[model samples]
Target: MGKLIVHPDYQGNGIGTALLKEIEKDNSGLRQELFTSDQSLRNLRLYKRLGFVQFKIKPLSKDLNLVFMEKKPGLLEI
Candidate 1:
């Protein structure tokens, strides 16, 4: 998972949601994942709102101030 970028002029307009919906439609079983830099709080919140849950948090080894946060679907209860 990597950072997704929307043109500055097109952001805050639900484009991201549309993209995610399309992705889901194309691959229903894919384990969607994303990694957010420490500075991206807004994106992090949006992911949470869309059913993604945090699975890992780690600091960037070279940059103490930078962190890597990953999110994906939770395990199913069998």
Candidate 2:
């Protein structure tokens, strides 16, 4: 799942979460990875709540960085 985009007007309506869930169902038992801009705190929080862990942060430039997160809900090990 690339970018789960819900228009600004649809924000807070669970649309993005639903989309992510569907993709997760399709991928069933695989680990998924995605990146968001460092400044997007809202998205970061949502991803974290969905069980994604921030494994690294890549600096894109002097003022921008990418937050790389991953999730493997089916995995039983830490």
Query: Candidate 1's residue-wise lDDT over 1-78, tens digit each?
Result: 255687889988999877866775676666776667656777777667766667766677655334333334453312
Error of 1 at 36 (Å): 0.8
| Model 2 lDDT per residue over 1-78, tens place | 456678999988888778877888899888899999999988988888778889999999999999999997674322
Candidate 1 stretches with Cα past 4 Å from truth are 1-3, 61-78
Q: How big is the positional error of residue 68 in model 2, measured in Å on the Cα after superposition? A: 0.4
Q: Quote the lDDT for 50 in model 2.
A: 79
To one decimal, what is the Cα RMSD in angstroms of model 2 from the true structure?
A: 2.7
Pairs of residues at least 3 apart in sequence or in different chains that clash in candidate 2: none
Candidate 2, residue 53: CA error in Å?
A: 0.4
In candidate 2, position 42 carries an lDDT of 85
lDDT of the structure predicted as candidate 2: 0.84
